[model samples]
Structures are given as structure tokens and as C-alpha cells.
Target: MKLSFEYGQGLMDATLPDTTDVFIPGETVQDPPFLPNIEAATREAIEHPMGMKRLGEQVNADSKVVIIFPDRVKGGFQADSHRKVSIPILIEECAKAGVSDRNIKLICSNGLHRKNTKEEIRSILGDDIFNRFWDLGNITNHDSEDWDNLVDLGYEEQYNARVIMNKEVYDADAAILVGHALGNPYGGYS
Candidate 1:
């Protein structure tokens, strides 16, 4: 049997045995209802997250915060995207907890993907956030190739390897991850 499936920006034709199984969200299965109010929902989730303390409660004055966001590959940055809405609210929470605006930093966690330029990051982050942090040099993309930009987390006995991460995240007193999660074959993607 032959079928067309989504691949990147378009679709591709594929041939498979008649018994092969194929499933797609909102196609083979019902799509979950869209959130009624994305902004409010995001705010609510952050302020009253499951099992975790409220964002504001975890931070305080003199705290240095690093907010890490997904890259363009993760598909955020629409007008009402979680990043656009949630990030500002997170900043507000930090501010409410007495963290200074200057102490807050935003990082694009690009991982193995190519480093996202400031312009590309702006597209993923929207104007208000991009402009707010960009000029202050508070927004930057992860550069895996830079030794000085990475922080060593020391050796992990369980994994038997050293764990390292971005220096900005390591340096912050409070590190926050802000991104979407997708259920997939790999368990989840963030």
C-alpha cells in the first residue's frame, strides 16, 4: 500500500506492506481540544505547577535566574505561543520575588542544532521579549563548540560520564526551563 505522510514542510509518498501500522495524532486519533486561553493556562501552570513549588516561591531577591527556551526547531513563537506568554509571566514572578530584571537571563537551548542567530532567536521569541533582552545582551544561543561557554557538572557515577551544560544555566541561582514537550517514539522531546 502507498500513502502520503508529513515530512518537514511538506508531505512524502511512502510504500509499506499492507499489514504495516500507521498512526497520527488528530488523524488516527482524536486531537486534544485546544486550550481555551493559552496565556492564562500557561500562567496558571507556572504559578501552580504540579508537584513543584510556585515559580515565585522558589526565587527571591539577589537571585540570578536563567530561563532556557527551545530553539526554532521545537515550533514555538506564534503570537500567543507559550514562550511569548509564559516567559513574560515568569519574569513577572521573578520580579515579584524580588529578582532584578538585570539578574534574569534567557538562553536558547539549541542542543546539536546549528547555533540560532540573534535574528532567528528573535523570530522564535517574538518582539517584546527579543527587544527587551537582546539589547541588554541577556539573550544568547547555546554554542556547543565553545569550551568557555560550557560548564562542567563533574562525573556522573550512574551514567559513568561527566555531565556538562551551558555556563549561563550553571551560574544562575535559579534555572528555569521553558519549552513545549511532545510525546514521541523517543518518549518525549523538549
Candidate 2:
């Protein structure tokens, strides 16, 4: 048997034994069109956010904003991808909130995975964002191996695990996580 797997920019066929169990979402499930008008819906969501202050209410000229997004592993390259649609809106809102472009940074939370290449980053962020921030040194990826950029949250006594985060995110005045909410194998939930 052969099955198609979603890969970057395209799909790949994987051959498996005939007796192997294969599960496909399309067989028994259908994902409804959650938000048909992404831009309008995003605007509405920002205007009336649940459990948090609106973007304009929280940021100011002095605020250091950090916008984080996952790499090109999950979100597709479609024009309506979260980064493409929501980022411009977020930037506009931040601007209205008095956050300057120079004070805002874009970080790719690639985590332990390899840093996304320039092309991959471009594809994920689109031309407008990539061109605006790439040359300005305002766009970057999280380097888990860069100890200086990692902040230790101390050891958790209950879980016996130490939590760490990117220092940029740790030090930001405001941080926004923008990405899809669909299922992913790595996190079980996105």
C-alpha cells in the first residue's frame, strides 16, 4: 500500500505493507470551514479578544513586541495561512497601539528542529514580512543550542523538569503566538 504524506511544498508517497493499519482523516472525519473570511474574522477576533486585553490596549511605543510563529512544518503555503493573514493585521494593530517597527521582532519558534532556511522562511512569512525584517535583523529563529539566548525557568519540583524559553520572548514587553490550531504529531495539538 502507498499513502500520501504532507511534506513541504508538496506531498510524498510512502509504501507500507498491505496488512499495516492505515488511518486517514478523510475517511471518517470532515473539518468544517472554521473561518471563511480569515481577514475579517481575524480583525473581529482582535477587536474582541477573549480573556485578554485587545492588542491596542496593551502595547505602546516603548513596548518591545515579539511575534512568534512556527516554522514551515505545519502551516501550509496557501495565501490564507495564518502568518500571511494575521500578521499584517497584527502589525497594523500594533502600529495603532504605538508599537514601532524597530521595537518589534519576529521569531520563528523552530524549537529543537533545524532552523528554517531562507526560502522556507520566505515561504512561511511571505514577501512583505521577509523583505521588511530580513535585512533589518529583526527576524530570527530560536536556537535551542544558544545557551545565552535560552532562559532557565529553574527546575520544576513537581515534574522534575526545567522549563526554558527564548530570551527574546522572555524579555519582551508583549509576546504574541500566531499559528494554526490544528493537530500536529509533535505537540498533539497546535
Candidate 3:
């Protein structure tokens, strides 16, 4: 069987090495059939009335909410990365929950990692969502060095795990962490 793959700009014409293992989904698995609807699937995952109902209902209009997202740079770009879906979804849900656009802040969870540039943010979140937050000055970096803006969360007695959180995150009335639940060597369980 022949299949076509969409390669990014630089990778066009690149040939797959013989060591590559290609597995066809249906042929290999005994799972049910798959339905294809790109826009609908995207909306279901990233917009209201589908996956975000619970989160949307819990948020109160009067409270200040900070939505944290993992920096996509750490895990190179993919067509269906959670970083792409989570931000815009949170924004739409926040609007539905009666949260003011100004009160909702989008922050990159860079931690000690390199800061994400405007272009990177735009690439993570499409131009529309990026422009909305960028224009309002609501997007900012997580500066781990700014002690004045960080709060100590005490330490573990056994391992002495010194936990310091971002002030903006701690000070907010509520925090919504939007991250992909994947296994990692860092062992950050949820």
C-alpha cells in the first residue's frame, strides 16, 4: 500500500532510512474503526461542550485565573501537540465561564528553561489567539530568578525538595495547569 506523508518545509524529499519500522493502525490492532473529522475533533478537544465542560463550570467569573502551559520547545512541534490545543481551549472556556479577557493570563511554564520568544508562542498558539493576548500585555515569562515574585513552599525532610513557585501563579485566585500526561525521565507525575 502507498501512503503520503506531509513533511515540514525543510524535510521535503527526505527519504526514510531502511531501519524505520512502519506500522499500519487497523492492520496491527484489533480496535474499532476510526472516524475522521479534523475540525470537529480539534473543536472537541480544544473548545467548549466537549472536553472542557468540567473546567469551564468550575471557574467563577469574579476570580483571577492563570492558565499555565508547558513550553513546546522542550518537545519539538507536532501537528497534534497538546500545547497547541490547550491554550486556545482554555481561552475559549474562560470566555464561556464569564472570565474577563484581561483577567486571564497565558504563561509559558518554562521554569528554568530558556524563555519562549513571541514567534514561538505564535507557533504554539495560532496567530489569532497569540495576537489577542499579546496585544493586551497578558503574556509573560516565568522568571525563576525573581525571588520577589516567588514563594517558598517549604521542603521535604527526606530529600530536601525545595519547592519555590512563581508569584504570579501563586498569587492568582486559581491555577489551571494545561499539560500533556506523558511519561518522562523527570518523573513529574501529573
Candidate 4:
């Protein structure tokens, strides 16, 4: 008998450390019956199971909703990425939950990193999702230096940590954080 391994780049690939951990999909785990569809599997892992009917249900209908996601360069983009699955589902879910299209905002969680260009956004979200949201000016960058809108979360004392967050996120009616669960060196940790 003979076997061969072919690795393809996906969301996990962006953040995967340089190592050799054979990811045998069905063969690696034995629990919770197999998922027949990749989209379904993606939903099961990323989106909330019991929270809102869709990711949109968590938002307030009268206010703006912000969806924060890690940059694609940080293990968030792929050829057939879950981010693709998650974003549109979120859009549809938001629509179903009565959140108007104009009220939804998609923000790349770039932090101190460079802003994502239109091309990068397209690459991360694909043309369909990009077309739907970008036209509304719903997509933007995380400007870490914008102190006027940042909220100081006091201090951690031990670590001298004065956590600050974007005021847009703080002022928004709701916030949806989307990211892969892969281990990270920078401690995004979600």
C-alpha cells in the first residue's frame, strides 16, 4: 500500500507555525459523527450554536453592528476558507435577524498592523461578500492610534496593563468577533 500527502493553503495555513503536524481529518478524531458538508462543519466550529438564529441576531436592530476579524495574513484566509463560509452566513443571518444591511460593519482586526486593501479584502472574503458589504462602506480598518475613540479599560496592576479598545466597537450596539481557533504566537487567542 502507498499513500501521498498534498497540502493546500487555507485559513489555517496563514497562522500555522513551521512544524509537521499531520492533520488527518476523519482519521484524527473519533467522536460526534462526521459532517457531510464542509460549510456545516465550519458553522459548527465558528458560529455560535445557541446564541442568535444567525450571527446577526446578536445585534440591535436600531444600532450599528461591528464584526471584527483577524487579518487574513494571520491565519484567516485560504482558497476554500471558513471565513468565506462564515461571512456570508453572517450577512444572511444578520438580514434574517432584522439588522439592516447599512447597519452592519465589517472590520479587519489588524490592530497595529497595516490596513487591508480592497484586494486583500476581496481575497479574504471573495468577490460576492466583498461586493455586498464594501459598497455600503461597511468595511474598515482597525486604527490602533485613534485615541479619541479608544476606551481605557483601567489597569491590570500586575502587568501594568491599561487595556484600550476602539470607541466604535465600544459604542456599537453589538460586536461579533470572528477568528480561527488555531494557536497563535501573538496571543489573539480566539
Q: Arrange candidates by TM-score, highest first: which order? A: 2, 1, 4, 3
Model 2, 1-190: lDDT tens digits are 8888767567999999999776656674665557778889988997889998998899998999999998877766778888888888888898998888888899998988899988889999899988988888899988999999999989989988999999999999999998777777677887
TM-score of 2: 0.86
Name every residue pair that clashes in candidate 1.
none
Stretches > 4 Å off in candidate 3: 1-53, 76-79, 181-190
User: Which candidate leads the pack in TM-score?
Assistant: 2
Q: Residue 170 of model 3: what lDDT? A: 91
**Backbone clashes under 3 angstroms, per model:** 0, 0, 0, 1
How many residue pairs clash in model 4?
A: 1
Off by over 4 Å in 2: 1-6, 14-31, 185-187
Pairs of residues clashing in candidate 3 = none
Give the Å error, residue 187, model 3.
Answer: 8.5
In model 4, which runs have C-alpha deviations exceeding 4 angstroms?
Answer: 1-36, 44-57, 183-190
Tell me how candidate 4 scores on lDDT: 0.74
Please give the lDDT score at residue 137 for candidate 1: 85
**Lowest-sum lDDT 10-residue window in model 1:** 181-190
Question: 40-79 in candidate 4: lDDT tens per residue?
Answer: 7766654566654545446556767888877866654665
Worst 10 residues of 4 by lDDT: 6-15
In model 4, state the lDDT of residue 12. 27
Candidate number with greatest lDDT? 2
TM-score of each model, in listed order: 0.80, 0.86, 0.69, 0.71
